[model samples]
Target chain A: MDFFQTIIALLESTIRLSVPLIFAALAGLYTERAGVFDIGLEGKMLGAAFAAGAVAAVTGSVFIGLLAAILISVLLSLVHGYASITQRGSQIVSGVAINFIVFGSTVILGEAWFRQGGRTPALSGDARFQTWDLPFADAVKDVPFIGPIYANLLSGHFLLTYLAFALVPISWWVLYRTRFGLRLRAVGENPGAVDTAGISVIWLRYRAVICCGILCGFAGAYLSLAMNAGFVKGMTAGKGYIALAALIFAKWRPVNIMLACLLFGFLDALAIRLQGNPLPLIGQVPVQLMQALPYILTVILLAGFIGKAIPPKAGGIPYVKER
Target chain B: MSNPYAKLPNWAEYGLIPLVNLVVAFLVAGLVVLLVGENPLNAAYHMVNGAFGRGEYIGFTLYYATTFIFTGLSVAVAFHAGLFNIGSEGQAYIGGIGVALACLWLDRTMPWFVVFPLAIIGSAAFGAMWAFLPGWLQAKRGSHIVITTIMFNFIASSLMVYLLTRVMKPLGSMATQTRTFEAGGQLPKLDWLLSIFGLNIGNAPFNVSFLLALLAAFGVWVLIWRTRFGYELRTMGHSPSAARYAGISETRITIIVMMISGGLAGMMALNPIMGEQFRMQLDFVQGAGFVGIAVALMGRSHPAGIIPAAILFGMLYQGGAEIAFEMPAISRDMIVIIQGLVILFAGALENMFRPAISRAFASFGQRSAAVQTKGA
Candidate 1:
């Protein structure tokens, strides 16, 4: 392949890899903005992935599977909200519990239902979301730069990928321009102030968490129904945590989150490409080092070696009403 | 104002609450088992039989418990200082590298006792160093310890993978593991000790590391509850301003506490590397580091609490294996769900039923007082 084609292909792969991260980071953005630290994004995603795959396989309807995924993800989010908000429990502990529960239950349920080593039966046809080719793709195939960009880079992605990208601007507008956004930010900063302002802090936080759940549901569905054929155990891997890191790296902003996710996605793509390949100067780079790069970068970014990351003041604290 | 429940009894406060939570978790787990078309009672019996029905089972239970004790103590120490050190898993992973390096260099020449001590120190030092950066960042750069530690875990996993596959794997070997250590480098098993008592433990991997775990627990008790540093750590956790007022340097305490915690986590390598596997390999730490978090929380960060909690989890692990072996219906993943439930009830929803229980006790006390007044 030529240089431009190679770049386009890399970019395409980067976009594909980052779609889930984008969705998860946005999910985290909504919750964390409302003072709820959600480390269970991974758990919700895993649950949704399994639900989507299993349901889609059984029903032969991808849309219904997507709905199932969203429902399950939303239920888990409500559990987190109830534990952290109503119960006034430790949010981190709640998040960790969710991850553990989802991680284990998915495998158990998968094994019992499918008997396929904790994997759902592979879906075909309507059960899986197929990539769509954009209009005029063949007509523009003869064009130079624009043709490759349109045909290879922009087109042929699953519907969820487009929605993921579209959600970024929507998230930014919702977070920055909407009335609900203002209240959500204020609650995260100081629930006492939000409460005094006559806003229901609990309800606002719950709303944000629900939004987080929906987005995570989309991310999970994309993984199982779009990217892969079926749900496998631990399939979400550490993407949820990586999304958390990306959220922090972006300082909890929506547009910045896109940039962070893309950066991580690029690194992940590079890591995959670098495996078993020899570099010019370093000779054959160890695959482990490449795999470790993203985490190393996250640690560096977190350490403020580049810049400081200040979380919401009341992020982890459970709000209590005063008499 | 005196709280009635607070005045009930120390045992109720410390012991009863945890026990009730554990029972609730198990009940929920039983329901899950029942949903899977298995008899809960039979499953429980199997778990019990698998964990302690014989000497070998008991040995395996203790063997698992030994690792949990180290990692649990690692977390408990950090908890006392108001620090969440989630990198124990990573620290332990890197500590294995230290053990491997030491074994490679000295195992062929040095005596077992000398090599063992050196390997322990090497492991602890490496683990401490792995934690030091995050601790420093949290103290000086205002970074969140949880994020940094979690990131460190991924890094450690990758680092170990590289070391095992590319760097340390013996030449001509296809496996991703270091060469096995000489017999002298391996820790002595507890078979002889059990034999002295006219008992045989079969091929269970329980070793002198269990003794090390006990000693470490006692050491932690002394360090956390008795020493001046312990006072400072508790003060800092309870009230940072008070600790500052008492001339405690937050930065110093953070670094020191993390180093100590990491050291404890690092010592966990002795069980797996020296006692069981006798070689460096990928994922030896498994999820023991994460389990430590559950252990510390359930144990209320007390050594006394952690020991039993560790043993209970150890039973869950060993018994879960046996159950999977005997009953294919109960997959190994089911045990993970049970563990998660325990974590959910005991850690996250710890105080879910506290108010109700306390209220009940308060009502009972009020009625008894009224009866006494009527009698008077």
Candidate 2:
């Protein structure tokens, strides 16, 4: 019973931790599906996190902060779109440049404005996203196994946490079922074909990148206003990259991305829980191993140690109408 | 509607375009400074004075440039073979282990000269091995080098932290770092090089690594421009299908290029571990590997160009510190902004101003031709 309780608690933390990864992975999905490879997800998240934290702290409104995050992320995404889509530049170089720009600008602006050595002031009530309990959560608290599962696992997440999970199915439906989804996927697989079919491939790519920006904004806001109290320096801390790994692990399917993120999050929660506690035979697990597991798994997946993880045919290649 | 890819005169291709990109990047950076409520010209003056105002400042700037030159060459080497090797950060981190191990084992017995050569081999070998798996996977298994190299970076970071905290920390020491090296592990300073000019290095950590970096740059220039192997790599980079038709072994070239690149990256550890710190410490690489990307792009992957590009970045690093000290509103992070802008304009948006410049040059040449015909 005690072990069951500990497992339940770990699962709860896993859900909470997986929220941002889910958002970022979905963001990657939108861009990659439109033939744009975005390694700048990290930069966008960090920039949005700083924007959200700064705005929330100043205006004392979480709603306004989220808007600012989305605006800033979308602006960065447009820059990327201009470089890769319109200018026919190297997508990888543009993404890398965005990461460096955000990594520097966040700290520079934060320190100049707040004077807290590259950190925003702490957020408080109303300025933060408060977690909400599901219906009957309190009513079923004293009940048995199923009750705890519903109350703990499914409830008690902040609004964006629920939104992140909800996005998985919505994204799947949008990508797989909608007419726009078919065109987006088609554009990724063969931009030349899309262009030949009388569609503006560049415009389609720009739209996909914009969708990516909006989702990444939510992920960043979740990091600062929902999960953490404020924007600490580099608070994203490679979660963006881990999300990219998860996206590849899932083969860019929305539902599979959610599962991969949960698995990575579970590893993280287990690592934190097992810090000093030694197991019967395996003994204490090194936290660094868990920290490095997502990257290791991604490399293995990319190497085809398991199933092959082929990306979009046109991914990372700029579309140029050559005569 | 004119041909955008038409060849230009050497001056415009090599000098004028890069100058325009650099100027635009600086203008954007200056705008950021203005938005932050600081005088752009004042900041610029301070940055230049800070980087070159004193002999010590010059020493410090050259010291930073030394690290950039090696890593920049690392990126350029792989780039010539049509590979994007982002794993230099990881390679450099693991290379530190090799340098530390060599020093830890032989510093008490071997002299500095003997240990230095062995440490170079150790660092290069370790760095190469770290990059080997990703290269092998790319060559043999068809995995993407960019993703694999990026993953390797995170793995290297975690591995280094585990090794530093769990294994390498001295007994009963509080810090998560190895013990300082003995005299044999430290490099002799090149203060005499400056003293020849009637100036002093003045407490700067400038050492012999700067000369080593210059020598490496020269070596890269020779290898890339004068060798059959260089021809093959450039062929493959320009068009892989053509190289395969010409009977160049794709797998072999890929793996060898990565090893050379990683080896260059690994040598960067010698500067920090032996020349500056005299010890192995955490994050000693300090994003120099990433800076290598910007340097390589700005230099157009030429060693002769890389040397100057490296010095420019070094000036930014040294000057940024001074600006942060003198101006309360601007921080050292501003240098990173400028670096990012340079990479964006010079690398990603390289052709932003090229078409316009090309058109202007095309019209001028045509007008001159008309004048010549009329005069004739």
Candidate 3:
């Protein structure tokens, strides 16, 4: 029973850890599906985190912070769109530039405003999204396996966790069931065909990128206002890249993206939990190796050890209309 | 219609456009400095002075530029072959391991000259081997080089931490680093060379690696522009289908280009490990590999252009440090913003001003043509 409890606690930690990754992976899904290869997910999330943390610290309102983050992320997305879509610049170059810009500007602005060590002041009460317990969480705390699963694993999470999971199904439905969904996928596979069919490929791509911006905003907000009380320098710590890896591992499917994120999050939680713990034959595994496991797995996956993962056919190519 | 700018001379296309973009970037950066409550002109003055005012400062700037030159050339070589080698940081990290291993084994018995050459070979071989897997994957499996290279960076960081702390940390030492290399393994500073010209640099870290960087730049110039392999690499980059039709092997070029690029990146280790730190440490690359992208872009992938671009960034880094020391209002992070602005203008938004400039030149050309007709 104690071992089972430990496993449940670990699973709960995995869910908590993967919420931001889920949001970011979904954001990548939208952009990549519409044929824009976005390595700038990291930059957008970092920028949004800084904006959210700064605004929330000032206004003492998490809602206002969320709005600010979304706006800033969308603005950045438009810049990316302008560069790659309108100007026909290299998508990778623009993405890399965005990362450099956001990474630098955030620290500069944060240090200036907070007078702290490139971090925002810690928030409390309404400024942060607090963990909330579900109804009857305490009442069923003493019951058997199912009860503890509900109370301990499923209950008492920040509102964003629920929303992140909820977005998985919503995103799946929007991708597969709707008119925009068909057009978006078609655009990614062959923009020429979509153009010939009379759809505005550029407009569709812009819409997809904007949606990506909003999702990335949620991911960033979850990092600063929910998972952490304040924004710390380099706090994302390559999570955006990890999210991208997860997207590729899932082969750009919504349901599989969530699963891939969970797997990565589980590895992250295991790494934290396994520190200083000796295994039967291996003695103590080093923390760095455990931390690096996800990236190693990503490389292996990309190398087609399991199966070949194909990206969108038109990804990283800017659509050019005939003269 | 023909591109008006395309009719311009090669020097004007390569040199003038990048120069204009750099000027615009600095102007934007000056505004950012103003937002941070510092006088932009004063900051600019300090930057220039800090980089080149004194002999020691100039030496320091050159020291920084040496690393950039190596990494910049690495990226430019890969660019010539149509590959984005983002794994230079990782390769450099592994290259440091090779240097450390060589120093550990040979520092006690071997002479400095022999050890230095061997360490160069060791570092280059290690870096090339590290890049081999990604190159192979891209060549054989159709995997994207960018994604694979980025993933390798994380793996390299983890491997370095593991090696430093768990494997290479000497007994009784708590820090996550190797013991210092013995004197025989260390590279000599360039102060002696400067003193030959009756100049003193006051103990700056500038070393023999700067000369190595210069030699490498010349070597790359010959390799990329003057050789048959250079023609093939450029042919592949311009149009792979044409190269394939002409019977050039894509896989061979991809692997070879990556190995050469990785070897160049690996050479960067000599600057930090041999010249300055004399030990293997974490985060030694310090984003020089990423900065190489901007350097290569601004330099137009030419050795002649890259040397100047590398020096420019070196000034920004060295001068930025000086400003952070002298002015409390503008922190070191502000320099990163300036670099980013430069990269944005010179790379992603490179053609933002081209259309307008070309139009103006086009009208001027037409007016000249009409005047010629009237004269006729």
- Candidate 3 local Cα displacement, residue A84, angstroms: 0.9
DockQ (CA atoms), all models: 0.67, 0.68, 0.64
Ten contiguous residues minimizing lDDT sum, candidate 2 chain A: A276-285
Q: On residues B196-275, what C-alpha lDDT tens digit does candidate 2 reach at each position?
A: 98778998888888888999899888888999998999998988999999999999999988998998899999999999
Interface C-alpha RMSD per candidate, 1 decimal: 2.2, 2.1, 2.1
Candidate 1 regions exceeding 4 Å error are B1-8, B192-198
**Chain B TM-score, candidate 3?**
0.96
* Candidate 1 per-residue lDDT over residues B251-363, each given as its tens digit: 99999999999999998998999889989878999889988988898898999999999999899889988888887878777767877777788887888878887888889
Task: Tell me the interface RMSD of model 2, in angstroms.
Answer: 2.1
Top model number, lDDT: 2
Q: What's the TM-score of each model vs. the native?
A: 0.97, 0.98, 0.98
Give lDDT per model, in order.
0.90, 0.92, 0.90
lDDT value, candidate 2, whole model: 0.92
How do the residues A1-323 of candidate 1 rate in per-residue lDDT, one tens digit apiece? 49787689889999999999999999999999999999899999999999999999999999999999999999999999999988877788788888988998898778877899999999999999999999998889779889989988899999999999999999999988999998998999999999998989999999999999999999999999999998999999999999999999999999999999999999888778777778778798777777777778877878787787789888988888874
Per-candidate total of colliding backbone pairs: 0, 0, 0
lDDT of each residue in A155-198, candidate 3, tens digit only? 99999999999999999999999999999999999999999999
Q: How well is candidate 2 docked (DockQ)?
A: 0.68
Off by over 4 Å in 2: B1-4
> What is candidate 2's CA lDDT for residue A102?
91
